[model samples]
Target: MTDWTPDIVAARFAEAAETARRLPPAKVQGYFNVWPTLLRMAPEQKPNDDERHFPPTPAAVERMLEAMRWMQMLDVDSRHIVWMRADHFEWSQIAKRAGSTVRTVQRRRNMALSQLTENLNEMRVVAASCK
Candidate 1:
């Protein structure tokens, strides 16, 4: 894949923001509800340092927003991802909540995670070019 310029990354962020803005509130909330544990894994912001180089540009900010959107997409899809994990013992419970069968949930969740990972890799390609 070709590296994305900062402008291209911003454009992608705008596109994703538009898509996310179009989602219904309930659907967005449902997505949030589906991945509560993932929420707790969010990294805290590091302390700012005066000596640090590469102060953030608008392009970098846009890239960060794009990364956020990708993460949100992953969060939305991670319900099935969790269910599919071999260590996930609450699969039956999750399936019941989702009104799906355990086996179906497992399959679907694996598929969702695979798709998310692929998308994340694409996003990373865009980010790497910014530097």
Candidate 2:
């Protein structure tokens, strides 16, 4: 097998933001046919972030969203590393963005690319099978 590079899988491995969908709020049902009239009015104040303002999110939906968030983070890390390497930018510049020492940034960049290597291989296999 040949060595896979970040440039090759950057596009395929990364999920497009446009394709992502926000899960709908859970439906709330009335407890009984005769409910109090005083409770019908919607609150005018903005919802507090601390409370669960929206209906309870489903477990599967929440898990999927969390997984997507993780994938997005990895995608950003992978692409940024690819861009930095491909552009041939100075270590100091990369370090500034990472907020780390040059050596640390170099190490992180290498790890990110290495992790993404598996994704590239999987994509290649899928592509070949489709042909």
Candidate 3:
């Protein structure tokens, strides 16, 4: 029910991108659905000795989990486009990666964001009326 401002959406998208990156390469793949939501898809394995050195934070973990919840509610194409964009991929790269044209990828991303905004607004309205 939090206000679905642009800042909130941007923060959550960034969080989701990080979470998707840390996803143990397993959850990120569609092989497993990881029930009740994708929130539990947080990385369980430690980074390899050759990988990055930073440690993870509890708040970061929670933020990623929260981001995944909204992501799970979105359609697959939209979610893929949004996450790819958040991870700093170019539209052309995303299109190639998705096997979609750049225009198609851009359209999907916009639709995904719009859907997310509408869903969040509905949640806000319901929450406000309940208060």
Q: How close is every model to the real structure, measured as TM-score? A: 0.38, 0.40, 0.66
Residue pairs clashing, model 3:
none
lDDT of 2 by residue, 9-55 (tens): 33323322212223333456764435432322345533543332332
Best-matching candidate per lDDT: 3
Best by TM-score: 3
lDDT of 3 by residue, 1-131 (tens): 55686456856888767755665443455577545422222365445543433334668778877777888879787788888888888989999988979998888777777778778888889888999
lDDT ranking of the models: 3, 2, 1
List model 1 lDDT by residue over 38-120, tens digit each.
22222553454322343245665575465465546655545433423423347777788668788987776666556656666
- Against the reference, the lDDT scores of all candidates come to 0.52, 0.53, 0.73
Candidate 3, residue 31: Cα displacement in angstroms equals 26
Off by over 4 Å in 2: 1-73
lDDT of 1 at 80: 38
What candidate 1 gets wrong by more than 4 Å, as runs, is 1-71, 74-89
Q: Indicate the worst ten consecutive residues by lDDT in candidate 3.
A: 33-42
Q: Order of candidates by TM-score, top first?
A: 3, 2, 1
